[model samples]
Target: MAQSGRTNSVSISHRSTLFVIPKWYNSATFPKDIMRDNISRREGLLMHNKMLFVRPDKPITSVKNNSIRYSGWTYVGSANLSESAWGRLVLDRATTKPKLNCRNWECGVVIPIRHNDEEKSSYIPSTRGITTSVAESGGGNTSAGSDDGSRVASVFEPTVPVPMKVPAQRYHGRDRPFFYMED
Candidate 1:
């Protein structure tokens, strides 16, 4: 999780960026009070156009929910926004190049942004798949998580498609910062 004070540390709006959050995560594990507090702090910076925050029109968990459609790409997976899950930065002495050390067996489906008719796209499974003209293999477990050749898939995928929501609505508070929600 990003620190609230760290919210003032960078300027990504100059490049046009936004952060999207779910309307409600499972409160049994993540409480509502904590969500409100973090949103409150970040809202101040977002209000000035430093960046944007969005919530979905329907609870992302509901299939019948009114989903917002976006023109850009999307990432669907169980990974968090942390360095460890994304991959830790490592300096390679031999090549003198920075590399992302991916030690865990993590996988995801990345949908690329298609802006025009000339653009072509495909979704490939990271575990095993055919090599295509547009495919690029990234980091993965070197040993396949024990040489048994058979392993169970991780059961930790998020219940809701967390990244599919678009900016919709936010409650207007005169003295408080506003967060975005998808309608």
Candidate 2:
């Protein structure tokens, strides 16, 4: 397929992206999204061209130094490491095994924010420019509890106690079971 005008391009308009970076690059503080005109088509097939960039304008400035895709990444089985090794964990809620209880390997969903692993931000900060911490957010407890410096509270939250009324006309007699229902 002879393609023209297919140069790597990115613009900050109305769009979402999931910028996956490796641990090594993540340490150096690189923004997940390519913040410059560095989209290079290192390889790919047909109309599906692969993009390569570490701030592509500055390949030397990668937040993660290793490969992002799963095929090239190492496969540590769902054992040995009880806690997930950062991005090494793929979360699955249905897993009975504790080791594999990390972030789920979701398919084709866009992320809301691009995290710069080297720096941190506060949630509605008094001032927005403080690089304070990395990934230490709770689900915002609506109920009070003793903070024993434990993660048991974050692992699960108490279900909202408010009475949720099921709209009668919403289902309309179609007996399609809920998503979790199984035959």
Candidate 3:
């Protein structure tokens, strides 16, 4: 966990592996120098300028009065991590020719964690679980807890904190992404 003033950064390490997220470039909530150690040498930086949603585990009641266990999900937007979102070249086996296939609209996908036997076959198991901690501004003490006071472990391993709030707020009526206009 990285600590500076009232800001808290979560780092999950097990065995010899460490996952660290440096401070975002233009964040209003967490300023620069939020990380405890210098991370300029890190291989990758999360440069997406979009919304992130995080939801820890929770319980819900079903229509049949049964308790439903909610795990979590990971969403990848088209603009950020989809090869089809940009463009991909493929060889047409039937036609014996090469062609380019492109997705013309914005899209995203939400992958849910395995929660039952039916999902066991389809869902992949994650090797690492998520652990979070918030430290005091100056005390530098770290503990494990999230907004729900529970540790969120995904069926998909190696979870990292997104550069946004947990359980992101829904967009209001007027909220929309910017689009190009020819005017």
- On residues 1-183, what C-alpha lDDT tens digit does candidate 1 reach at each position? 232223554552221122333453423553332122122223434322121122211112323543432223344556654555677888988898998788665566654322222211321122222221112111223234221111101111122222211111121232122223534
- Per-prediction CA RMSD (Å): 20.3, 21.3, 15.5
Query: Which digits, one per residue and each the tens of the lDDT, describe model 2 over residues 105-170?
Result: 422321112223332221122122221111122222312321211221211113111111111111
Query: What TM-score number comes out for model 2?
Result: 0.15
Between candidates 2 and 3, name the one with more favorable TM-score: 3
TM-score of 1: 0.28
CA shift of 22, model 3, Å: 14
Give candidate 3 regions above 4 Å deviation.
1-53, 57-67, 81-104, 114-141, 144-154, 157-183
lDDT: worst 10-residue window of model 2? 160-169
lDDT (Cα, 0-100) at 40 in candidate 3: 17
lDDT of 2 at 1: 6
Clashes in candidate 2: how many? 10
> Clashes in each model (backbone N, CA, C under 3 Å)?
9, 10, 2
Q: How well is each residue in 76-98 modelled by candidate 3, as lDDT tens digits?
A: 67454235455778998899798
